[model samples]
Target chain A: MDPLSLLRGLLDTTEDAARALVGRERIRLAVTGLSRAGKTVFLTSLIANLIAAGRGARTLPALSDATGGRIRRVFVVPAGTETVPRFDPEAHLGALAADPPRWPERTEDFSTLSIAIDVERRTSLGGLLPERRLTLDLIDYPGEWLLDLPMLRQDYATWSGETLARFRRGVRAAAAAEFLAFLDALPADAPAEDALAKRGYTLYRDALRACRDAHGLRFLQPGRFLNPGPRGEAPLLWFFPLPEGARGGLADLCARRYAAYLDDQRSTFLDPYFSRFHRQVVLVDVLGALHAGEEAFRDTGDALAAVASIISGANWLERLLGAAPTRVAFAATKADHVPTRARDALAALVEHIAFGARGRAAQSGAAVSCHAVAAVRCTEDAVARLEGQAVAAVRGVLLQDGRGATIYPGEVPMKPPEPDFWDAGLFTMPEFRPPRLDPAGTSGMPHLGLDALLAWLIGDLL
Target chain B: MSGRPTPRVILDEGTAPAPRLDFGWEVQVAPPVPPARGWSTMALIGLGAAVLVLGFSLLEAGNFVAAQFAQAAWLGWLTLAVATAGFGLVFVAIGRELRGYLALGTVDRARAAVARGDPAALRSALAAWQAGLPEGRAKPGDLGNMPINAACALVEAKTLAPIAQDAAALGRAAAVQAFAVTAVSPSPALDALVFGWRGIRLVRQVAALHGFRPGIAGTVSLLRRVAVDAATVAATDVAVDAAVRGLLSSRLAEHVAGEAAAGAVAARRMMLLARAADEACRVLPR
Candidate 1:
């Protein structure tokens, strides 16, 4: 390398290329969670902080004097966008500034952002003291993707049969059966009927929801089936032979279409999703899963292992397509639900659920780490005294009757009942939503350990 | 059970491949096959070769092509016709891989923009963001990857050069003073610069290994304390330093240092980030 050339490269531009070069590093990060686990909210908040840092505004404790400088600029890129993800400072700041802060909207698919930061270089490194710009790309996606991973292991028949069976058992099945009967009335070769099609689609979605409610299966998006694009047209549904078929001809056609649906699904959703990601964050609503009962817990354990199996076996598919995720983070969401005192116990529960799957990933040379986090603070405080006994409760704003009121939401039961308990009902009372924090409490609720999560995943980029 | 091995089950040479089994076997019909995809690697290599040739030709001919075209109307017309044909081919290729190319380019640009600074790009981005702010279209999150902070730093350094140099020595002192000016608070730009770098360094270690650094462990423990204890900055600084040192020391060997050297560097960066963050806090209008 010519010193003069280097000098010229250094001096020829005022764009701070020198700083970027000095700061350049690569790190991969994945953010994911179960359905409605506040993945999107956490992502947006983390990004908001990063963007706020860009203005040389806001103070982040981790980035304060003891650590280093804060984030300077932020960019968020939607998966298909030309630019990186941007920190929507307005969205977050506005929310924070509101009389009562609210969580960001949930995300349905994968979103990513690559952030760049320029730090003040320390003088002792024997080089020019130009500030270095470090860039980190943080990737966020739906936790549903983790659920779909297990489907890769099942053939078309198995997936459809199991789903159909579940639908038959659940309360939503009556409506579904009616819809299937309607399917029986349609002619096999008749022109597409919009009304019938809509009914059929409704049935599929309803059945999926039923399964989700009763069985805790989360991937319920209906578009995956109805839209297979040009190549998939009608033939795909042949594999998922609908029981709606009353005659031999109808049965044959249904079988063919089911097959097509399965094939299309494998090609579209299963393959690319596993292949594209370089790392994965599997957010388990373990408490919710646990609360669902023994069967639910067992189901979760099975599902997680099943997901792991597919990922490992999909090596062939990944090789055929591209790189599989090199790392996996099996995170337990709503860590804040427990009193801070029992966070370790919550972590232990998560560790038990993830141990087998994580070990498998490690055996295969893929990196796996576990974390317990609360994307949105459901509780303001770690512990509360209820009826004179100290119970772990979250203190935050809640709805009393129809008005917003302060309340101490009771602690998650130390041991929730069996799987049949989910059938009982969701936690409808305001015990989960606590009292609104005063100005002092607002600082950490929206994001906790998000920085450390960011640090662990893509800190090298900065 | 028909013990005798039923005559239908007996093998016979007469069966003889079942006359090639004309269940559409020899019907001259095509098998069900997906449409062939484009030869990507071949095309890319060819395109690369073409670019190389064109570059070499330009270097060799210098102003020759322009001069030739300028001298004759017929020559210019011929050139235009060739250019049009080339464009048509390009359009066809674009149609084939337009989405893929766009996606690749987007990722590439973001990566390049982050890895290296392009002032024109940064200025354009900054202007867009500033303009987008009022319309509620601007996303501050973009600052994370835009290198805009660095650009702002440079802008501050450049703008404040005369101001800083007036009271100090020229050149180095001016640069140092400019950096100081950039550090002036309420500028999340400087805060991000310091924190983002250390954050990246931290993430790298975490991803690389479990317990990769003693610093992370210490940091985690410190964070545990902070979760419950609202300690002042002075009181917490010691714990922070210890944690940062532990983290930095973990990466020392592979990252161009022994434990001591890495610790020093870590201490310096942590302090720098802390200082900048504090300054931002102070300058943040209450």
Candidate 2:
């Protein structure tokens, strides 16, 4: 056996013994977006790719290879307890296997999956081992939940007054004003109703958007209170509204509820998320943000900052107070969107935005790294015609306005470990969308980085 | 009444000498109450009274000068009698209050028992009972022994005053039960209480019928058998079912005596109800 694989085997045996002595390990992952950010599709694909790695065909190179550091096996098992349902591997896998790929339905109210995989170590201690089991505890939830974070920090009157002001000045103010009026009229202790809460939730959501639009607040979920999960439950989610009185009154209520909500989110979402893993990989769709222009880019930055806050805030902070993440890889996803030659530039852009002041809170400690990856290869290198003219294009899968347009967005060069020069503003085109990329040929596997990321986090522990 | 014949009675009664009473007064008799006042008063009065008496005697014996102090003897006797009587009253008052407080405490305990047994107050009472139970301190396989009454109370609480209680308990219960279901035998009865039929299906999917071999699965299989036995008893016992339902859903029923009969009905109903509960807990994507 190779040295990396041998190390992995020792880790696996140790991990098995640990589980026997210490019960089960708990790990968590969180995926979110501001509205319509393709979170569902990305998550579904990430998991599908992870599971398909061992099938030989359409495998992730990082997970299936023996020589390189990679994951050897992946299995979807029961979550923490048998009372809850097992993670639906078939549901996600089936979606990826369809003739025309489709995104999995969005998840709400944080869901968890405990996945087991055998991962090979990148560094060698000699050929005395084979492979070890590395468990990944994944969590998925709606982006709308992020809105409640800021609420936890602010009171109702302050939240409301500020929201009202945004309604008066921002783009969605007209709709926001009407929704604000409805929220203002709600009885403090009354039972929540879908009709009433819907209006209020929508207004609050719109207010978030309006604030983001005007003053560049990053947490815009529900886009306008479209509801994160099943309706009715939305109202029960305690959010801080601007306090009605300056001294106390409604502010206390809002603050109290906000604290309760924050606690709930932590126990239910945050705590369980970080329990099982030693590393983290945060995926960002840089192309989409670039397409949306400056405001979207700024929102993405703020969103990264917010992500940092959440990781370093009360929830993640309490668990990892002094012990920071052993390894963190902040990835710019969907690298196929850019030409291979500029893949490094794309990675640089993501690194700059993700590690900037806004994302610093989340970036602290650990060996932070960045990458550009495409889980599913869309196309190979080739020139293509566009707009009745020969343009420098690389062949790629593209879903163009509900139709397939086989066009090369551009050629992507195999990236060096550290590139010499790069710029973020080079790609200025808006309205750019990937045509439905066909599944890559059954090449051995693609992307070794995913497993390397996992190896770095828990390789020693395993 | 006259038609019935009166049987002749033969008395074998004979006088039996009672065992010699050897009761020790020191053992049975209560300790004597402590003196309320110091010994100085007794000594001073006794001395003065004796001195006065001695003077009187001296006068009677024709000692003229000592006869002048005779009135002082009556005054000293009066002071001794009054101090003894006052000390007695203080002990009596202290004894009475102690008896009253004990009586009050008994009454309170009886009232709590009655409240706990009341169908109207069942839900909250059961909640109080479970909260008071040693749940968190339980060992790995200990959950199988959770009383059926507590489970019944939970079901009732969730179904009736669902608004009052938050989801914290349900979530914790879910977590604990999850451990039991996965780590122990997948007992259908406990499964019904935890997730119902749907949960059983999930168990089947995640765990091999034989288990994951050396780890938590082995622990689970052994615990599962024990849980099943307990569940079977709970299923047939009406009181057990009521308690289980109360503990699980917080619904308290009126009758506690016919629990065996009630449990039979409940166990049957649970076959269907548990499936629904499990389905309800499944989270869907937006």
Candidate 3:
């Protein structure tokens, strides 16, 4: 490089640095969760409420009060990158506001949105200071993709061994029957053939889909095989886990594809987005997992642990060059599905599920906390008479029929349920219809514990 | 048990040539050079000098003998030190504030470019921001792949346009019946069945377009498979509705009804075909 060019570069860097030091601070908030964990809803409500609160609507009491009423204004800003898709808040909000409200489509790929809030300084002698603006960038991605991070550290053989072993037990075994049969028919050293590869890939992909949809399993890997987004129908995603201790042309082919898949995942997914997140909110459907069965519950826990390991155990090169230390919050979603009285139990269950990950994060000098929240409250507390005794219940519109009903869902255990509890019968969690909202604005989207969540996430920043 | 040799069994020819598997991994390039640290060093020095002078002043004020240094020379020296400290503090504060401002400016510029829907401008702004980062700071990777990706997406969309239009027309016709059935009788099983029927129609249409002619029996078989696939997808949709929308409505009914209106099934099939076409073309002798 020319000396003058170098000097210019140095000057430009310094000037930019100075501007950054003085300008509004930018915070990247990553919203991640397993499929159906309410990440989309949480993000929507959070943004709505934040914008509302900025407009003095007073929806989020904790957040509003914490800002000392200095939030002058808040507004949505254009996303900072063109490579990534922008989160369509308008389309989502419109879906909820339709005549017969419908849910928005689930996130299939990563997206981003940014919000800017102007806050006045609060100090005895700072009355002369101008208001400061803070820009928050929210990144949304599927939790299934996050599960693939561990594959970056594993070779094809090891991943295959572990994956095959996992499917051999529990509900997955039944789902994997067809795929397993196909695997058995092929010899490891057999000549590589396109017909065979496609057949194996399709069978395995079908099994993975069945495992998730039928059995409600959360530990499914190679997530893109199920939700291939823009890379749909691409040859790069046509690889499946092979049987262990197999070496030959077939194994070689699968191994190569596996490596390619990992490369695509890292460069196209994690590096640009996951590695850049400054804060992360992990949403877990604790009640749903628990309802599924013991296997599902344990699988969810393992998924959390794996995600935490990746978040806290970045390689030395990445650690030195990655984004700032991240703050993590694990939120148990759909709190309104259970009764208000069982809220504590729900929180406890989530805490227990996240305990190991939380400990690891704390060890890594990152703050971790758990909360039970409902981004969109659907049910309300009520009482029902059962066997001449009053029992706590929840009243809401039945999702099956638009009729009103009161349900006394079984109790949520405060601790991890014992094996015997499984025999005792699990609670039937009914889905409730969302309450009507003011289509005009975000003033009436009822939520539970969102304020507290906000207080925990960005209270200090306020 | 017969001594005659059994008819020899031979597998059919492969649908396509075996995919290449080079397993050639690309080495990650070296990280970007860290931004210049001259501003940071200068700011630190100024902050340190301010703190030292302020601390000394406080200590001197606490000492009784400090008043004896009120002579012109001593007083002048003290005043000069305090002024210098004030200047240093200002420099530090300005440096910190300016850095933040510059960072925010970069994002603001990028956002503006995006708002204008100018891809070139957005790319340019991003590159400029990356170049402005200090030493040791991680720079964003190349966005050169974005245009190509966008082009591919556009091509795929173009390929599926006509299929989507046809599906939409068919969906409009089915919507009336679907709505009436759903309204009159709300049953999860019934909804699943309706969705399964729609899935069958969709698969038949897609298969026909792809030149795979299936008879009635084959169509029914395909329907069974499509139904299973739709049912699986509905399960996920139901979960998503429960968690996000707080609605317990049957996702199968909703999905079928929605697809009927928007022609998602046909569009989706077209997308799949487009991809397959791309792959097949790639493997063709060229």
Q: Given candidate 3, what's the lDDT at residue B222?
A: 44
Clashes of each: 89, 77, 28
Report how far off residue A33 is in candidate 1 (Å): 2.2
Binned by DockQ into CAPRI classes (incorrect, acceptable, medium, high), candidate 2 is incorrect
Question: Per-candidate RMSD vs. true structure?
Answer: 30.3, 38.5, 34.8
Clashes of 3: 28
Estimated TM-score per prediction? 0.48, 0.46, 0.59
lDDT per residue as tens, model 1, A1-462 = 246534433443323344346565333344545566556656655655554444443324444333355344444432355332443434544554344445444444344566655555543531233345565556554454455556545654466566566456544356367655655566655344444444565566555555556655443433343323334334333223244323444444444554555455555555433434445666677766665545556556666666666564334334333244556767677776555765655666666776667766676567666667765555544344444555555443332222322233222333333344444343322323322322221122344455555554444334
Give the least accurate 10-residue stretch of model 1 chain A, judged by summed lDDT.
Answer: A434-443
Error of 1 at B29 (Å): 73
lDDT of model 1 at position A18: 48
Order of all candidates by TM-score, from best down to worst?
A: 3, 1, 2
TM-score of chain B of 3: 0.26
lDDT of 3 at B126: 63
Task: Give me the runs in candidate 2 sitting further than 4 Å from their true place.
Answer: A1-58, A62-72, A78-80, A83-85, A119-131, A150-199, A206-218, A221-227, A237-240, A243-260, A274-277, A313-323, A356-363, A379-402, A406-462, B1-286
lDDT digits (tens) for residues B1-286 of candidate 3: 1231211111114433222111111111111245876657766897799789867766664452345445566776676576568667866765655553444444446554443334566677666655653345333456656673353234234333433454445545454445445445456578657755654555555433322334554555444444443442343444443443333236866664543322333333333333322222110100
